[model samples]
Target: MLDTVGLTVAEGEVYRLLLVTESASAEEISGSCELDTAAARRLLLALEAKGLAYPVEDSPGWFAAIPPEVALVPRLQRQSEALEQTRAAVLEMVQTYQRGARARVGGEAIEIISGAAALRQRLRQLQDGSRREMLWFCKAGYVAMPPESNQEQFAAHDRGVLYRVLYEQAYFDDPGSVDNVVEGVRAGEAARAVPRLPLRMAVSDRSVAVLPLASPGAPGSPRELKAALVRESSLLEGLIDLFERYWEVGAPLRVTEEGRIGGAGPEDAASLVPEDRHLLSLMVAGLTDEAIAGQLRVSKRTVQRRVQGLMSLAGVATRMQLGWHAARRNWL
Candidate 1:
């Protein structure tokens, strides 16, 4: 550790030997300090350069150590001064790097959000900070999240913050899915449905967008969670435009006290639209309301209402009876 004083090992040993022996020839320093004569001479030269040792006028190769207060203290002071200069240089470089980072706008417009918990936290933060509209596009994918997430959206919807959501037909396959859509509609959410949605994305107030990372097949699974956060930029605007284009074609839906609500029309269960029929197939396959809602990216309430509509048309009080009646009537 004492080597920080700028003394080489041999030089320190030779200096210490000189302090004990008072005066010594290179040979004496080598023998006393367990160093070779040439190494001893080199060590003395290094000490002399640091003003720690001085050569004898009468003895050409002999040396003496200066007192510690006069020699060691001065060398340590010089090292400390050099260290201070190094520290100042490093601080200046850090400041320069940070300034450059600030000057470059859009350099970090997109950030990768990894881990399930972290993505949830950031999503909630973005949602809470939203002051205007929220746009969502959802589809079948691998992800596990809190079931109560939609409750938060209800509060946002109540505050005059518009919510527009697009979902896949697969969403309505579950029981109770219709109730969520019904409640959301009651709370001022403009909900829509389509056969399928491409990605899962959430845009908050036209200011930020969050989406899962693009994957070859499924977006991601809970065990290997990954997502992205994007700030306002050319890319963000493009995403906004994409949402609008889909919104244009999405079938608008609302809940009414009566069995009838507007979107696509068909008179009976046997004459249900292809999308509604697909939902019936999922229900007949026995997926639960929550699972169907997750797969279709719709609310559990929405799914339930659709099943109720089917049951009403089939004149079946039970889901099992509706499934049997749909089959007998050749309803796909």
Candidate 2:
């Protein structure tokens, strides 16, 4: 607690040791704190000058510590008063800076957030302040945020906000890369995977967008990344359209236990979600299983299992034969 008043680490240790003692000689202080004898003597004299210790009345070389209430309270009060004065000055300076920023930016909706720290703070604020919808375009080389660090989206989802996330294929190279998405899906979020992403960005409530100044190339220091924020304007609108275009091509996340899905009967093509239909379209387009899995943000094993389940439901034996049989069965 005394450290808050600017006490050094070693000095705080010495004072704490002294507090439990009525009086101690330098030899005793050095032995008790395991400090060098010379250091202990220096500490005691320093404490004496600081009004926190005094020479013992009868003992020639021993010293006694003042009680904490008598020693630290006044110093802490003085520090608090100084801090309040500094706070007032900083507030006034911030007002002047804001005015200057408005004059410089004048009527432009774009803003450059220079440092990684400021970008992170703004992202957090955007997520916390969003009310209706959020969109994401994620790829490698961008700032890596842990799920727990900024979970405002999960709360927003529970409140019935729409959150659509699209991840580039490279993002799933790590085995557990989709854990965050799994949590989001469980909370009613919509997630998908695309082979490539045009940029790394997040748009909140369709009104604000944040994007990196450059494509982050690899998992380097997040501190090295810089970004820009665009508020309601044509640029933000164009970004939204780009995101939706990617979303339509991306494969949906499937982590559920059910192997076979809707569109079982001859007239149920309309029942399938766009992502499931896209998976079928890709399959018919001759993509390999690994490629399909990469696009879907799921394990190859999961893709295989789902395929086998579909074959069983269609009563077909081979991949080539199943396409014809499944198509006739109204499985698109």
Candidate 3:
């Protein structure tokens, strides 16, 4: 609309009239519009000032519109440029304000989100805003979101968000939890496992962190569940550091070609098939033979037989010696 170029509604009508005619006098403008002659003349002068209209060469009181390409286009371009500049400036100011606000209320930076629903919602929000990476400490027990149920992590990972997840050994005790880990790894998540974790936490891009205020498995109703949403604070940095420290000591997890859990092993174990690697990884993670059999859907005897075979292949006389051989030989 001509209003964007600084024309009033009546002045825009006058401009359009001039555009469609060779030239128009104030009387012609007033007859074609709601404005009177004096008002129409004033509008025409205003348009002239904006370089959208000019006096006809041989006529004293007639005006014609400047070619639209010569007038409106440049004005529109200038307006667009100004708007972009203003937007950038406003964004800068907003960032400055957020920084200062966080500084002024350091104690308020950690928000205590209550209830299972609120915790789940906050976790999703943090994942959605993650840009570079997401770090997680996955402990055992059902929380607001179980690992298999966290679809947001997959969505973020698919969009190139790096996911570094550390899982406690008990996490795999959950039925289908290993398969879920395998699925995540195949989908580009970098996963590892330790015997235990201190707590459950998720950090987004290292800028914000969310951790449970109480143990998830504590006997309590959903309404009693609580978590802390920490932002840009020393506490957040410490949480990130904790995650990294655990990740360094954790055994890397992998998936077999058959879509089962596997693990890193020495080059000597490369000759072992996917199933063997899968078995070794679970064993190294401290899963009992019964637990390993359940995960692989095999009998406990079958698991023992496989262990015996691995030990025989390593020429070891005992399980402890086999573990040593597996590590020294990089067979598991």
Candidate 4:
């Protein structure tokens, strides 16, 4: 079989000859090797190019034989090292080029979505089609009261996508909000509530991220109100880093007594209620209703009933709508 590093027969023969023989005139080499003078000269020149031979300038019409140990080995070593370095440099250049290309494509659309319907459409896209994993940092209260996409969230859970959420701990205080989260947790979502976060953020599969631009006290109808939607890998990396910093300290979602949702807190099994809180928690954790039932040690019908009750309280028609409302409200 041929080796990966290629070599021609003539090139190999020239190299071997130089390795075994002492310096000889071109005519002598041609006669010994049964090659014409022109062919011999061409072979010697080719070997010289490969650093395997050097001319014997003191001798007329003659050349010096470079031993493999002294000439071929060291030269080949250098060539190998240079090739490795060149490959590494080329890989880095390609990576930089890809990052720049993504930035250009993602930064082009600085669009403003004004109406609630358009906003809902955009939110639906985020909720329905996200791949890889979803990362969210928002107000806990807002997610718990999500407006309209709980069903979509559940569907996404069934599709095996990861959903990680971080929010303020204060959201756990409300019974309804807690119930909403419990439902999500039961549906296979990974939920967490923290003391605080930077701003409302939603990242879909590391491909797109949306972050609120307006401050806390911005005017209601401020036309300048905006949010950044970044799909660039470079920017996405920055956002992912920020999320990890907060994720490291944020608590994981858990169930509490009285059918309310909590996060990584002391257990109060006695106070725990049999409400939809468990189901909602599963939903937020990206679990399906069937999975949630298995986890909660209950039947699927029981899980569905709990979801229905939570949806009624949130006043949403579909799971997608519920997720949207919750995200808009910073609940998930």
The candidate scoring highest on TM-score is: 3
Q: Where does the lowest 10-residue lDDT sum fall in candidate 2?
A: 257-266
lDDT per residue for candidate 2 within 1-332, as digits (tens), equals 55686677788888878888878878999999779889999988888888888999889989899987888988888888999999999998988766665322435577767656777788888888888888998775356454446677877876778889887766654444546555666778777666678788999999999887755454456576667888888888999999998886665554443322211333545645555554563454335579778777788898788778667766778765555554444445
Candidate 1 vs candidate 3: the lDDT winner is 3
Model 4 / residue 225 / CA error / Å: 4.9
| Candidate 3 residue lDDT tens string, 189-276 | 9887777899899999999898887775688999888788888888888888899888866767767677766655446455677577
Q: What is the C-alpha lDDT of each candidate?
A: 0.71, 0.71, 0.81, 0.63
Write candidate 1's Cα lDDT for 1-332 as tens digits: 55887777767777788899888888987777567889888888888888889999998988888988997788789988999999999999978855663233376677777667767777777777888999988654324343235566877766778989876665555445555556777778787666667778899999999887754255555547778788889989999999998776565564444422232224345367855765654554345677657656789999999889989988999976775566456453
- Which has the better TM-score: candidate 1, or candidate 3? 3
Give the TM-scores of the predictions, in the order they appear: 0.46, 0.51, 0.62, 0.43
lDDT of 4: 0.63
- For 86-191, candidate 4 gives per-residue lDDT tens digits of 9999999978855664334444533344433444455668879986688877563332225334577777888998888776644444335545676777777777
Each candidate: how many clashes? 17, 0, 1, 67
Poorly placed runs, candidate 1 (over 4 Å) = 1-106, 141-147, 174-176, 214-223, 258-332
By TM-score, rank the candidates, best first.
3, 2, 1, 4
lDDT head-to-head 2 vs 3, winner: 3
At residue 193, give the lDDT of candidate 1: 62
Pick out the ten consecutive residues of candidate 1 with the lowest summed lDDT: 259-268
